[model samples]
Each structure stands twice: as C-alpha cells, then as structure tokens.
Target: MVCGLLRPDAGSVHVTGRPVSTAAGPAKQLIGFVPQDVALYPDLSVRENLRFFGRLYRLPRRRLERRVDEVLDLVDLASRADDRVESLSGGMRRRLNIGAGLVHSPTLLVLDEPTVGVDPQSRHAILESVTRFGEEGMAVLYTTHYMEEAERLCDRVGIIDRGRLIAEGGPRELVQLVAERDRVRLTAVGDLSAYAEACRRLPRVEGVARGGDRGDVVELVVKDARSLLPDLLDLAHQQAVGIRSVEIDEPDLEAVFLHLTGTALRE
Candidate 1:
C-alpha cells in the first residue's frame, strides 16, 4: 500500500505529503522497495542487476553509474560486483537485494524482511547497512518479526497482528509498556500441549506457549514470575510432566509480543 502497488481498503496512504494511491508516480519515485524473496536475474552480474533497477527509475546514465558503485560499496558487495546472482551465497544475495533498492538513492527505503534466510554474518551486515542508511538521512521502513532487530534498528515500531495495528512506540517505550509482566521459561518433558493448556489456568498467568528445539520448552507471561514458580512446578507434576529446569526474565519482548497478538511473532 505504501508502495502504491495496491489500493488501501480504507482511508489513505500519503508519502511526503503526496497520496501514495493517487499520486503513485511521484510518491513511488521517492520510495525503494526490497521484498523478502530474491527478485533478481540469476544470469545477471551483481552490477548488472543494480543497473537494471536504476534504469527502471529512469536515472540518468552518469548518475546511475555513480549510484551503482555507491550502492555496491554500501552493501559490501563491491568485491562481488561481477559475480552472478546464482553464484552468490545466500547472505551475499540478500545484501545485493538491498543494494538494488538503494541504487536509486530513494528518500524512503521499504525493506520487507531483507534478512530472511541469510547467514548470521550476512544478517549482521544487512543490519549495519540499515543503520548507515538512517545516519545518511534516508527514511527506512523495516519489517521483521524479530523484536530484537526492531529494538536495534528502528527508532519507532508499529506491531501489526491479524491485520491490526496493535501497538506503536519506541523500543524502550514499548518495553516499559509491558515492563510489569514477567516471563517464565520451563524445560520439561511429556504431555507438553496438555501441560501448556493446564498452565493457562493458573492465576496471574497471562500467556502460555511452547518453545525450544524439541518443543519441550514452555514459556509463559505472568504477573509475577518469582512467586509463580512453585505453582508451575506443581502443575507440571500433576500433569505428569518432568521439569528439567526453570528460568525467569528470559521472555522479554517476545513474551510481550505473544501476549498482545495472541500468537508468536515469527515467520
């Protein structure tokens, strides 16, 4: 909707005082969109892909050439400028995806999960580029399910759940909003689903979700984690679930995220 590709169902979307749906050409020109999936020609070199996107914006030859080099360096893909999209690693391709968007030097860059499926190193690199973009006075609208990324990269966050804007605020502000809530993590075995549902009935426990690699972790958001530990242990025993360990203050933003949306904020 912000990109002017689709009309909003209600109200209006404006970009820099221009209506995105009505004045699409003018508004879209100021925006650069990077989707989650790779959207490049596998046969084309990194430089060629950037040049193609720049041309789509009708950028002048000289300006486009300079921006291409600048974007390559910006995304740390300058060394791989001649490498084809198919030859690049998952992380490298992710960086190039971002470079394609920056090729036009847009006023606002919209990144839709730019770090998805990338390596840890590449993810870190992409995050640094986002920081630099903001420092250089570019407006970046970054969308990610990870609250830690939002806390690190965004000055403002608007959490959308089930197509609704449930919360919007600064990272610290959002944290403080749910600060009173404590998180409990339990590593247990056997009948986890039944145990989770049983945990929900405990007083002052607001949210319950099963996590961990083997699905043996039970996470809960409660009014007071310290006081609720015994009840959780007792509930586990009653449910015939063996408790291996318990933890508190491990939930943070994710638990609050689950509490507000009634679903985990993950892909």
Candidate 2:
C-alpha cells in the first residue's frame, strides 16, 4: 500500500495527512519502501542507482545530487558511490538499498525485514540506520519476525499474525498482559506429561508447557514462581518425576507471544 503496488481490501492507509487510496501519487511520494530483498540494479553503480530513483521522483538535479550525498553520508556509503552494486559486500549492498530509499526525502519509510540474511556486522549497521531514522523524526513502519529487533528499535510495536494484528503496545506493556509475573523451567525425567498436567492444576501455576525429548523439560509460568517452586517440586515428586535441574527465566517478549497465542513465537 505504501508503494502503491497493493491496495487495502477494507481499511485505509494514510501518509502525511492524506488518505492513500484517494491521493495515490502525493501520498505515495511521502513514503519510501525498502523490502526484504535488495531491489537495486546490480549492474548500476551506487550513485547511478540513487540518481535514477531520484529522477523518478522528479527532484531537481542539484537537489537530487545533494540529497543523494546526504543519504550516502547518512548510511556511510559515500566512499562507495562509484562502485558497482555487485562489487560491494552483502552489508554494503543492504546499506545502499537503504540509502536509495531515502534519496527522495520521504516523510515515512517502510522497511520490511531489511536485515534478513546479512552478516552480523551488517545487521548491526542496518539497525543503527533505522534507529537514526527515528531519531531524525522519520516515521518508520518496520516489520520483522525478530522479537529482539523490535525490542531494540521500536518505541511501540504491533504484532501481526495470519494477516491480523494480535497485539499492539510498548514492549513493557505487552509483557504485562500475561498473568504470570515470573517463569521457572525444570528438567526432569519420567512421564513429564503427567507432571506437566499436575503442574497446570496447581493454583499458582498460570501456564505449563512441555518440551525436550520425551517431554523431559517443562516451563512453568506462575504468579509467584519463587514461592511456588516448593509446591511444584512436591507435585512432581508425587508423579515419581526425578528432577535433574531447574532454572528461572525472566518474562520477556517471547513469553508475551506465547501468552497471547498459546504457542511459542518460534512455532
């Protein structure tokens, strides 16, 4: 929708105070979209790519050159302006893709998984660019399956599943929605399913999930984990479960995702 390639089926998309469906050109001009795949012409040089995209937006030659330089500097790709896209590293190509999007000075930037398969260093660089965009007052609609990325980059987040938004709030606010204040993980042996079912029936246990081979490991979310550990152990003992180890994990976005969907985010 932001790129004018797709239209909403029912709802509306707004860009810079103008409705997108009605004011396609003006509204689209305010948006810059960087998709998961790099869209640069591999045959073109970095500067050539920027100049081509800039001209498409009808920016004046002088303004386009200046804007290209500014964005190149912003993305730290100024030194590679004359280099062909294929000559650059994966990280550099990703940076160039980001730089190309900003050449027209769009008010809104939509990045969809910009760091999908880059090296760690390149991924870090891309994240920094996004942070800088927000710092520079650019409204960015960034979408990713990576929870840590969302936690690091977004002031607010909207979690979508199956084409519908399931949760929308600050990270801290969403984590608070789960009733469990704390979580405890236990690795035990012998019929863990029975132990898990028993734990689920316990009063303080808010949720219980079985994992590991033969369901030997279980994660329990509870209102008061520290106090409930004793009762949890007792319940396991009654089922003849042999406790091997125990660990407590802090509640985080993964927990929030699990609580909302009744399945782990990875699943």
Candidate 3:
C-alpha cells in the first residue's frame, strides 16, 4: 500500500506526506523497495543493472553514471561492479539488489528480508550497510522474521501478526510489556518433565517447561536465575536429573513476539 501497488481496503496509506493511491506520482519517487528475491538481471553486470534502474527514473546520463558508482560503493560492491550477477556470490548479488533500490536516492527505503539466503559474512555486510543508511537519515521500513535484527536495528518497531499490528514500541519497551525476568535453559539427561515440574515449584521461578529436541531440556523463567541457580541445581540433583549445560537468556524481541503472537516469529 505504501508503494501504491495495492490499495488498502479500509484506511489510507501515506509516505513522505503524500497519500498512497493507484497513481502515486510524488510518493513513488520517495519510496525505494527491495524485495526478498534478487530483482536483478542475471545476465547483466552489477553496474549495468544499477544503470538500468537509474534510467527508469529518467536520470540524466551523467547523474545516473555517478549515482550508479556511488551506490556500488555504498553496498560495498564497487569491485564487483563489472561482474555479471550470476557470477557473483549470493551476498554480492544481494548487495547489488539493495544498490538498485537506492538509485533514485529515495526518502524511504523498504527492504523485505534482504539477507534471507546469504552467507554470514554477506549478511553482516548487508546489515552494516542498512545501519549506515539509517544513520545517514534514510527512513527505512525493514521487514524481517528475525527478531534479533529488529531488536538491534530498529529505533521503534510495529509487530504485525496474522495481518494485525499487535505491538508497537522500542525494543526495550516491547520486551518490558511481556517479561520482567530472565530465562534459564538447562540441557540435561533424564526426567526433564519431572525436573520442569520441580523447577516450577521453586520461588521466583514463574514458569517452567520441558523443551529441546530430545525432550531432555528444561526452561525456566525466573525473576533472578543466578540467585535461584543453587536451589535449581539442588532440586535437579534431588530429582536425579543430570545437568549437561546451562544457559541464561535475557528477555528480548523473541520473547515479546512469542508473548503477543503466541507463536515464534520464525514460525
């Protein structure tokens, strides 16, 4: 709707002070969209792809050439500018995709899961580039199922579940809405269900569940996991649950997402 590709059924959509409709002339100029899939010609060089997009906005030859080079550098793809899209690594191609959206120097850059299938290194590069874009004052509408990404990158987030905006706030504010405690995860051998039940009875432990792939792990949400660890260990010993590993997780976007949606974000 913000792109004016699809009209809202009920309410209006706006971008950069312009109302979004089927014929959104000025609003379209201010918006840049980068979809999940690479929107580039595999047969074209990175520079060629960028030039192609720049020309779509009717950029002058001199300006388009300069913008293409600048965007290539912005995405850290300057060296790969002449390489064909098919010959580049997954990450490089993804970077080029982002570069294409930036050709017009848009006010609002919208990215949809830009790092979905890239290598860790490429993902890091893409994330860093995004951070810089925001730092430089670009209003980015980044959509991703990755909770950590939202937590780290967004100043404020509006969480949508089943097509509804269920929660909206800064990461810390959203997390505070659902949790006032840390979570302790214990991977152990034998009787995890019994251990979970026992853990639930402990003071300060608000919730407990048997989890993990083999059903050999116990998760506990507690007001203070460290302060309650000794009692947790003693009870595990009493229940004959041999502990293998322990992890303390602070509440984050994932917890908030689970709380509001009753399901994991990735699910």
Give the true-structure RMSD of model 3: 3.6
Q: Rank the candidates by lDDT, best first.
A: 1, 3, 2
Write out the backbone clash pairs for model 3: none
TM-score on alpha carbons, each prediction? 0.95, 0.81, 0.82
- After superposition on all C-alphas, the RMSD of every candidate to the true structure, in Å, is 1.5, 3.8, 3.6
Q: What is the lDDT of candidate 3?
A: 0.84
Model 1 spans > 4 angstroms off: 22-24
Instruction: Look at candidate 1 and tell me the lDDT of residue 217.
Output: 91
Which pairs in model 2 have colliding backbones? none
lDDT of 3 by residue, 76-110 (tens): 88888898899998878888899999998999999
- Once fitted onto the true fold, the runs of candidate 2 whose alpha carbons sit more than 4 angstroms away are 22-24, 184-222, 227-246
Better of 2 and 3 by lDDT: 3
